[model samples]
Target: MNNADLRQVVHANSGTTCQELAEMFSVSHETIRLHLHQLGKTWKLSKWSHMN
Candidate 1:
């Protein structure tokens, strides 16, 4: 997905988990984390029970 689209989705669903995002985009969670980082967003894995 393009950066703009990802950014829009992230902003629209600020509370969504990385896994959910990965699944939505048909990518890996790590890829979502990298994209989020590039978009100046930080994801706290500790916030999600399944991630920990």
Candidate 2:
């Protein structure tokens, strides 16, 4: 349940790109990647398709 806001955003927009998430959160894409990694998720096929 960490980063719940980010997780909700990801779930709401399953097709959102990393760059988009970064823009939305006013952070770097690398930060988004790190959060996703911490959340046990991953990017695949141009989307954050893997979730946990």
Candidate 3:
């Protein structure tokens, strides 16, 4: 997906893990992490939980 699309997905699923988002986007966990950062957001344990 594009950067804008990635940002929307991140915003919609704020509690999603990097690994999870990676799978959803068919990208690497690091790639998702980068996108999150690019979107002015960072994936944290509190923001991204396995429970969610």
Point to the candidate with the largest lDDT: 2
lDDT of 2 by residue, 12-32 (tens): 877898889889999998998
- How well is each residue in 2-42 modelled by candidate 3, as lDDT tens digits? 78987777667777777888898899988877766666775
lDDT of each: 0.74, 0.83, 0.71
Instruction: Evaluate model 3: give its lDDT.
Output: 0.71
Give model 3's TM-score versus the native structure.
0.73
TM-score-better candidate, 2 vs 3: 2
Residue pairs with backbone overlap in model 1: none
Error of 2 at 42 (Å): 0.7
Off by over 4 Å in 1: 44-52
User: Model 3 Cα displacement at 31 (Å)?
Assistant: 0.7
Judge candidate 1 at residue 27 and give its lDDT: 92
**Which sequence of candidate numbers ranks them by lDDT, best first?**
2, 1, 3
